[model samples]
Target chain A: MIKRNIFRRTILISLFIILFSASTFIGILDIKLIDLLKLDREAWHNFLYFRIPRSVSIVLASAGLAVAGIIMQAISQNKFISPTTSGTISATQLGMLVALLLFPMGSSFVKFGFAFISALIFSIFLMVILNKIKIKNIIYLPLIGMMYGSIISSITSVLAGMFGKLQTVQSWNVGSFTLLVKGRYELLYIIFIPVLLAYIYATKFSIVGMGEDFSKNLGINYKSVILLGLVLVSIISSLTYIIVGPLPFLGLIIPNIITLIYGDNLKKSMIDIIFLSAIYILICDILARTIRYPYEIPISFVAGVFGSLIFIIILFGRVKYGSK
Target chain B: MAQNKKLQTGIISLAIIVIICYMLIKLIGVRSLFALKMIVKVRFPKLLALTVSGVLVTSASLVFQSIVNNRILTPSMLGFDAIYIAIQTIIIFLLGSVNFLLNPIYNFILSTGLMIIVTLIMYRLVLQKSKNNVVILLLIGLILTTFLNNMVTFLQSIMSPDEYLNLSAGISISLTNMNLDLVLIALPIMITCIVLFYCDAKRLEIISLGEDNAINLGLSYNKEVIKHLIYIAISMAIATALVGPLSFLGLIVVNLTREIFKTNNYKILIIFSGLLAIIFLLLGITILEIVGHITTLPVIINLIGGIYLFYIVIKENKI
Candidate 1:
């Protein structure tokens, strides 16, 4: 078992490296390692300014959300709940709009604070609603979440439209790394803290997953852990959303795929989740750039196409009924 | 015999008339015969479009909800709106704005056709596999919608700013500045659908009662599911294709109709849904126009309707 795990990790990490380099180098501007070695200004500028930040953002955002998904599933006790399906991204978008409207020209921290707060509030709201509903079918969880997200997005659109910032909000909502520059994409790193927090509280989250009564009997603070798990989810959700907009289904798909292989051992499978998410999003980002050549489609589009297709297949394979 | 029902009906009609009059009052300047002809040719079609499409969509949604035996689920979950917007995107992407703009007839055919086809494909995929699990079906449709929505936005991003702007304007449900030709073309089909739906009102009400009720009443519930779903899909596609996508309006209207009319009779409920739809949409459009039409009609309606959906869900016994 140990050897098999090692072998799997080796293959996944190797795959990640290859895809990472490929995503980093393949773009509109042609640059080679030789130019960076020779202190080439233009090559270095493009690499540092656009290509590297974008590629890094891709990796960071994917890794962050993938772990966030695991955290969400554990705390919510439903495999279907993720940032993509839940209202977190939509709430983040709305909060960003609020920040934009309020500050107009505020610092990124203010926007980040706003995004995090709204996502946290949204998490609390959804949990309250979820607690009230006795769901037999797991699909109902994501169903309610998706409707909530759409409603939140509708509110966001109305506000953005009222402010005459509809186009800008629309652009932000479309998850893409094309506009990533040095300063713009750096805020994505903050999501990494939530990821670390996920790792620390992994066991508690899985225990929380069992249900409120079980967790409390096990001498855990049921509510606080749930709050903590959701907070971690909200943080990663809002930060990555503010940075890369939204990577559609990245969170949901990665954890699901990871679970199939590694089971629900969050502590053990965290690295694997990161590896898979990084590689998956790297492939998406590369395709988004290369598919239309000079004019890049958003990574969310590529991810959505691939993710939903994969999700349907996975859904059909496992979910025969709502009986479970 | 209830005064409340009478009062509600009177109130809705009054709101509809007041809003319509307010909208038309602005167009009061038409002294010349040529100007009168212009009003008849141009403004008349838009007024007709809003009223007809509103009624069309609300009825379609009512039938859909009744078929599924769920109050909160709108026909939008059938992936109608997303497919409509997606087809519009593909048209703009392929042949530029001219195909969608100068030739409204082609988009009308292509858009509605694609919408129906997508719905059929979804039906085949989910219904056949799951033996008609509505929740699973809703989930699949929701997934498809988000995917298509993402695809449309991505395409719009690739488009030039001007073209993208035009596409956004065209896709968003707008009350003002509609195509007269498309509205005229859609009017006959929408009316036909509404009439056809009304004919099946009694059967639908039986279905809405519950599966056992439907079965006891000699309705082969499972077999009839596909037929009604197809009808719902086609008419919804037609309605959404006509007036962009008023996704939440249907949910809001149908529920309100049931609440106000307090009738299990699909006939009365369907007619009330139509009138309430016109009242809500006309007032919504009036609000949009009053507020400088800064945003689209669907956005505001969706905002209100979404909240109302949560209200229904929360107020219901945990289903």
Candidate 2:
């Protein structure tokens, strides 16, 4: 039965792969079919070269975000929480604001560094608060996260308003792939790879999630593990926000989708989430570029709409099943 | 004993609201209130609108809480703000600067009405199946909000720069420079909703216990919820359309009401919550106006509300 299930899953996976490939092919065709097909080889090469970096950035950013979200939900033990939902995204935005207004001439690396450090600091504070406050019920935690997120967001909003940069701030906060190019995309890869490695090596993360007491009994340093998790999450998330801007529910939705299909197994879900996020973003990117002809809908909007629909469905299903 | 405590809190909250409103009127740099022309034309009417806005936000929040059976969810979750942004962006994109300056009311009504309709449709669609799950409803609402938000952003990016700037200026919620006419118009509807809510106050409590429980107790749960939902929808439409999305103000006020009154009865909670909301809203506006002399008081409220929510969460967790 297990083998059969695996086979079925593999087949489904293959189908999604086909869909992604076909979509990519069509997307490429749509972009260049008119002029490139009629032009010489050099033009085709130029188009391909130009598109490659942006496509890679979109795929990596989406997958990393999805994986990070899955890890967060697993550690936090709540599907509703995301970097965006938990003020982590806002903290990153705050970092960007400081970088922009305070250190206007700072390099992207320096700005991202500031974002990483600030987000880490903020997220650590949240972890400490969470640790000190014994959560008797789970539902309230998300509310706290939401509130924290709003506070950070409001601060950004107020600052933006005062500085007459609300629109610029909002556009960045909204998260779009429009600005993705060869230069900025590298940063996402750099932050993503190391954090991904650290996450894998941290066996205590899984044990800690089992329960603090259980981990302590098993000689796992729960606080350190959690702090480490927070740091890892902060760095990766901050970097992604810096490069791709804010993806709204990019983190929350894909992870939840994976868990619904694959159950609570973290390792499997992690892989599923990565692949699923890639496919989801690819399709969204394709649609974004395709739907309006010369103009593109921001990928954020596509993800938001599709992600919300899926989230609602999952929530309804979960509620119908009467389980937390 | 409980009733007396609620009544006392209610009275205190009301007094605070009045004081804050008076202070806000003064702080808006509206001196020479004794002058009949300015007072009637600007000062008095502005005060009335702020007062009414506070009542509308609180009562609407209360009714929303009753129907959803959760204090956490608000109508903004249904994408009213998102739709508002979408409409505003589209209007500015299409009309340009001259047309907007030409007819502000036409723009307001058209955009606001479109938002209401779209949000209503989204709410009705997702809310139908998962009426029992508050979390589900909230999740869907957030998703819809994000979708609409994304759509607006996408449109704005492609829109002409002048159009984008024009829409952005108009979109931010502020009570500082509200047109007296708009406030006057919004006031009657706000009061009417409150009156209607007062009449249904008893049923709201029953509905709050969830539809199954309410139905078991021989109440028409669906009917009760439907009515309350409509009230919430209208109230949210007015509040958000009047002023852009004030995320944590309602959350802070509604939660504060629960904390202060320490009761679940709709009549007491709703009434007190309205008063508390007004006080908080005015207090927020006052502090921002007095200290920063800033236009973006809503941001300050959002920050304070966020902190208050965190405090409540920690406190609740402790228990």
Candidate 3:
């Protein structure tokens, strides 16, 4: 087992290296690998300011979303649940709309604070609803959450329309890494704190996954742990949305693929999940930038297409293989 | 006796609401015969488009829910509107706004044809592969919608500002901004689809008895489902092509009809749901006029209908 584990770890590290280099090297202005050795001022400037921050944000957002998905599924005890489908992202959008409307010239900190608070409240509300309801089919839970999301989104749209801020909201609705310059994307670093908390409490999440009664029987404080997990998910999702709009199905598909391949033990699979997520986002971001040459497609577009295709494959594979 | 009274009450209330909306639209500010004629001419097409689309969407959704044997499913859930929006965006992206704007008929045909083709492909690829798992089909449709929505957003980002504005307006549902010629063309197709659905009312009732029971009763379950799905795709395409997608209107109206009418009779259910749709659309238009905002009717419908859907799901879960 140890030998196999070491082999897997090596493979993951190699894959991460390859993806990271490719993502950093390719853009509207290509930086050839040999250029790095020359250390020219232009190349160095672009590398420091443009390429590095964009790649870092992509990696951070993807890993953060994937980790959020895992925590959500763990707390809900439903493999299909994710931040996008669970109404968390839309709730955050609604919160951001309110913040933008109230404080048009507010600093990013104030906006983030409002969004963080609203996301926490909305997610806790959703969790309470999930607890109160007895859902027979796991599918209905996500569908209900989606309905809730649409309601929130419609309210946001209506208010935005009223304020004539539809354009502002529309821009926010489009998720792109193209806008991530050095100073613009530092907020994404907020994800690191939640991700670290997630890693620290990974085992507790696994215990919560076994059910509230089971956790309580094992002397775990089920409610607080579940709340902590949700707060982590909310922070990750809300921060990603505020910084980069929404990337639908990323959270849903990546963690699902990881769990299918690596199993559901969060402690054992967390690193692989994060690495694979970064690799996936790196590939998608590269495609988004290169697809139209000087004009960039949104990162969310590539992710949506790629993620949903994989989602369909995973769903059908489950049906054919009769795997849970 | 009680069922008759309830049906009568529904019809009477719906009729009263329709009349009020019509008057509010047509005669709110008119002062003379000349003004009345001018206002009627403008409002007539808008009202016609509203009524036809209302009937098309609601009936299509009713038949869809019955055929799938799931109360929560709507035709929009099948990715019909997404396909329509994607086609519109792609056309504008490639052909330029002038070409797309000048040729409304061509645009309509292209969008409807593309939606039908996409639906057919999904039926063959995802639906068949899942062995008719409705939940899986719904999930695939949901994913397709997200994919297409993102594609549209991507194209919009690259588009020029003027083109983006036109595209955004084109994609939103508005009773006041519809093409009169397109509505005229859509009216006949929508009526025919509704008639076909009405003819299949008994079959739909049987189909809703769950798939196994229907098949055991000698119904060609898969074949009938495919037929109804085609009808649904055509009507939904026309409705979406006429007005942009109204995601939650169908669910709200159909569920309201089922609750108020309290019968499995597709005939009554279909008629009442269609009426409820019209009432909702007219109410929305009036509300928009009252509020003096540019928000489309679907926003209002979705705001209410989405909440209603959430309530229904939670209530059902509690039971």
Tell me each candidate's TM-score: 0.91, 0.86, 0.94
Q: Which tens-of-lDDT digit does each residue in B171-207 have in candidate 1? A: 8874455777778788888788878888988788888
For model 3, the DockQ equals 0.60
Q: Give each candidate's fraction of reference contacts reproduced.
A: 0.70, 0.65, 0.71
Chain A of candidate 3: what's the TM-score? 0.96
Indicate which candidate wins on TM-score.
Answer: 3
Per-residue lDDT, model 2, residue B237, is: 72
Ranking by TM-score: 3, 1, 2
Candidate 3 lDDT, A1-113, residue by residue in tens = 87887798799789888888788888778777677789877888888798899889988998999999999999999877888888787788888989998999997777788
Q: How close is candidate 1 to the true structure, as a TM-score?
A: 0.91
lDDT score, candidate 1, position B92: 90
Alpha-carbon deviation at B60 in model 1, angstroms = 1.6
Score chain B of candidate 2 by TM-score. Answer: 0.86
**Winning model by DockQ:** 3
**Please, what are the lDDT tens digits per residue for candidate 2 over residues B147-237?**
6767787777667777776776677764544676677677788889888988887888888887788889899877666667667777777
TM-score of model number 3, chain B:
0.93
Instruction: Indicate the docking level reached by candidate 3.
Output: medium
Number of backbone collisions per candidate, in order? 0, 0, 0
lDDT tens string, model 2, A12-45? 5886677554543454334554566687686566
lDDT of 3 at B267: 87
Candidate 2 structure, TM-score to reference? 0.86
lDDT of 1 at A282: 92
